[model samples]
Structure formats: structure tokens, C-alpha cells
Target: MNQQHPSMEVMCHVHNCKFNENDYCFAPKLEVNPLQGSGASNSKEALCTTFQPR
Candidate 1:
């Protein structure tokens, strides 16, 4: 499959993640979302909503 935004660089720092490589994600696509309840106090309120285990 082709990456949705191959030219766009999305960095990842979660070393334990399977799709992470050198602080970047290797998935064909990525989806980021805010955690439920709708109020975000900080970056921690957000989530990598599309991350999947290897």
C-alpha cells in the first residue's frame, strides 16, 4: 500500500511503538485525535488515535 503523505514527515519518539523508527512513524497513514471529553489542557490530552501494535 502507498503512504497517504509520503512527502510529509511525521516524527515519533515512542521507542516502544512498532511503527516508530528513529523518532518517526512508518505506517502508511497516521491519525491524531484528542482524547474524549473534549477539553484539552495540554498536549497530553491528545492521542495518536490510529496507532496499532505490531
Candidate 2:
């Protein structure tokens, strides 16, 4: 039997990010967390930017 959802790809441009490598985002899933400073408050957010449902 096959799964209902298919795998997808996500890309990110956040440099210095732990998950960033060679301008490619290898994050298997989207997970957001609270970000402090940098002007935007409550910036914690998680999302699957590269999700493709089939």
C-alpha cells in the first residue's frame, strides 16, 4: 500500500542557519521557533515552505 501524502522539497536562504548548506535546505520538516531581536518580535514561526502534496 502507498501513503496518502508524498514527499516534498523545501528551500531556505537563511545563512548561518544550522540547516543551511550550499544554499540548499535539507530540512525534512518545517519547524518554527521564537526569534529574538532583529526588529521582528514574536517571529517564531514554522512552515513547510517546500511541501508538495500529491
Candidate 3:
């Protein structure tokens, strides 16, 4: 199957994440969600659901 990478770079600071490489996210695909409410009002409210422990 063909795989497509995102044109934009995804920065990550979670060192324990399997997809984190040099502070950058390398996951083939990523998922994010709000910690609460219908939408996130700020970055603090946004959660990285794609994180997986290395």
C-alpha cells in the first residue's frame, strides 16, 4: 500500500513517546483530542492521543 507523509513537520516534546525523535513526532499518522469540552480553547487543553510509550 502507498503511504503518504504530511508536508508539515510535527514537533513533540514527549521523550517517552515512541514516535518522538529528537523532539519531533514521526508517527505515520497522529491523533489529537481535547481533554474536555467540545473543543480545546488552548494548547494546554489539547491532548495528544497518539502518544505511545517507547
Q: Which candidate comes out best when scored by lDDT?
A: 3
Point out where model 2 deviates above 4 Å. Answer: 1-6, 32-54
- Best to worst by lDDT, what's the order? 3, 1, 2
Best by TM-score: 3
Per-model TM against the reference: 0.65, 0.38, 0.80
- Candidate 1 overall lDDT versus native: 0.79
Residue by residue across 1-54, what tens digits does model 3's lDDT show?
999766878999999999999999999888889999779999899999999999
Model 3 spans > 4 angstroms off: 1-6
Residue 23 miss distance in model 3 (angstroms): 1.2
What is candidate 2's lDDT per residue for 1-54, written digit by digit as tens? 886865666566676666677766666666544344333444343333343332
Clashes of each: 1, 2, 0
